[model samples]
Target: MSGIEDLLREDLRGKTPYGAPQLDVPVQLNTNENAFAIPEDVAAVVAEFVGRELRGLNRYPDRDAVALREDLAAYLGHGLTADHVWAANGSNEILQQLLQAFGGPGRTVLGFMPSYSMHPLLARGTATAFVDAGREDDYTLGPDFVRAAITEHDPDLVFLVSPNNPTGTALDREVVEAAYGAARGLVVIDEAYAEFARDPGSTALGLLEGRRRLVVTRTLSKAFAFAGARVGYLAADPELVEKLLLVRLPYHLSSITQAAARGALACAARLQSEVDELKHQRDRIVKNMRAKGLPVADSDANFVLVGGLRDAAAVWRAILDEGVLIRDVGLPGRLRITAGSEEETAALLDAFDTVLERRPALFDLQEQAK
Candidate 1:
């Protein structure tokens, strides 16, 4: 081993960095990024605000990002205010900060498997113990199962990703509450895809009022077409938000970033229209995949998870050879497909049909409803 490797922290020595291939392909549907680009009017607003913030670059940006937090509070609209919100570069940083404050050596962070893969990485980065639990065979997590895991693991931090990544299934509100009641420490609900859920009320934000230990994180990356802006925030009791301040680095949110997020919030109407269209595409993908007898998960996010393949990697390569890129998330016999533009979706379906025609044995014809 290299001398530098020997000098590295023990917990980090053998760990590889998180990555998703960013290949240049004709129809890219691997990452769950918003299909639409920022509208011209919204782009103008972001440019204007950023231009104004450039003059004050000499001074330090707002250490607390108060103005941006206020705009985010208004955007969330669940009786939230600046004091109840905290902003960061992205949800990853926010999660890391939470671990810094609530998790450390000897403390445990627990999450169900097949959720956001980053949960364990964030825990390990903070020198925290990570516990992997299981979901139902169908990938739906029930309250009883969650409560049992919490009771057994007794983790210092519990992560629940609604509209979970890779699987794209959302948690019921009752399940969230049960987890909160069972957990002795902090509970964070990663709702990064909440904006695209089938029902507007399918959120843990409403459950935040009386629950101080509960946290709900939201991002502008998906539905808002602001992934490039890297804005993610959390809503919780002001007391919990205060604890994060102790661990967050000073001036974490750059002046340009703050202004850009606020500008995106100002153009919420246009952004919602884009989100609606993406939802349409998501539903269309789900419908078409099911008709072909694939077992597709019912999704509230901008993606669908399909199973019953004989070899997922082989299918993934076939799709790539057809100039379409989708994600093979290492789930046995399954692949995740991001909802793209109408033209892109059509291209992907055509690619799937053509490939399946050649290798009809690749997938099972019996459809499993989820």
Candidate 2:
């Protein structure tokens, strides 16, 4: 082993970093990024804001990012104030900070499986124990299952991903409440895809009113089309915000990032207008895939989880060969696809059509659903 390799932290040895394949394909849907770009007017404003902030490049950004926090709090209006919101590079960093504050050696973190893949990685990165729990066969979480698991494991932190990744299904508000009630420590509702939800009001933010241990995290990456800005924030009790501060480094957010996020927030209306079209495409994909007898999970986000392939990896490769790419998340016979533009979605569906036409045995969803 190399000298540095031997000196690495024991827990870090032989660990692969978390990342999806960033292939340069015509249609890239592996990662759950917003398929659209920022609106032209919003881009112009963001450019101006960043340009103005460049003069202050010599100085560190607002260490607490107070102004940005205020903007974020205003953006996520569940009666959240600046003190109730915390911002960081992305939701990954936000979760890591939470783990740093509430999780460490000897502490356990639990999440429902086939959800966001990063939850356990963040927990382990913080030196916290990681535990995986399964969802129902339909890839939905039951409140009773959540409570029973929480009661059994008694983890220091719990993650309930609304509009869960891979599965593309949202949790019931009752499930979130059950998880919170069962946990003695912190309960985090990762709502990174909240904006794309079928019902915008169906959020855990309402459950946070009187609950001190509950936290609802959201990101500007998806609906705001600000993934490049790397802005993620959470609304929690003011006390939890205070705790995250202890573990976060000084000036964690750059001046450019702060200005960019605030600029995006200022143009929220223009950004949200694109959501309706995206949802239309999302629903279209679901309906069409179901008509083909595929076990397509009902999606509240801008993606769909499809099952019934005999060889998911093979299908993934065949689709890529057609100049389209989706994700084969190692779930047997399943793939996750992010909703894309009309043309891109058509390309994806066409790719699948070609595969199924020639290889009907491989695309049998009815039998696979069993």
Best by lDDT: 1
Per-residue lDDT tens digits of candidate 2, residues 1-370?
A: 5797689888988899988898898999888888898878889999998999998899999999999999998888878899999999998899999999999999999989988888888887889998898888877889999999999999999988988887878888889989988999999999988888998877999899889999989899999988888989999999889989999999999999999998999999888778888888898898888888887877889898888888889889988989998998989988989999999999999998998887787876665332
lDDT, candidate 1, residue 257? 94
Query: What would the per-residue lDDT of candidate 1 be over residues 1-370, giving only the tens digit for each residue?
Result: 5699899998898889999989999899999999999889999988998999898999999999999999999988989999999999989899999999999999999999989999999998999999998888888899999999999999999999999998988899999999999998999999999998998899999999999999999898998888888989999999999999999998999999999999899999888988898899999988988888888878999999988788999999999999999999999899999999999999999999998899888887775655
Q: Candidate 2, clashing residue pairs?
A: none
Model 1, which residues run further than 4 Å from truth?
Answer: none
- All candidates' lDDT scores? 0.92, 0.89
> Candidate 2, which segments miss by more than 4 Å at Cα?
367-370
| TM-score to native of every candidate shown | 0.98, 0.97
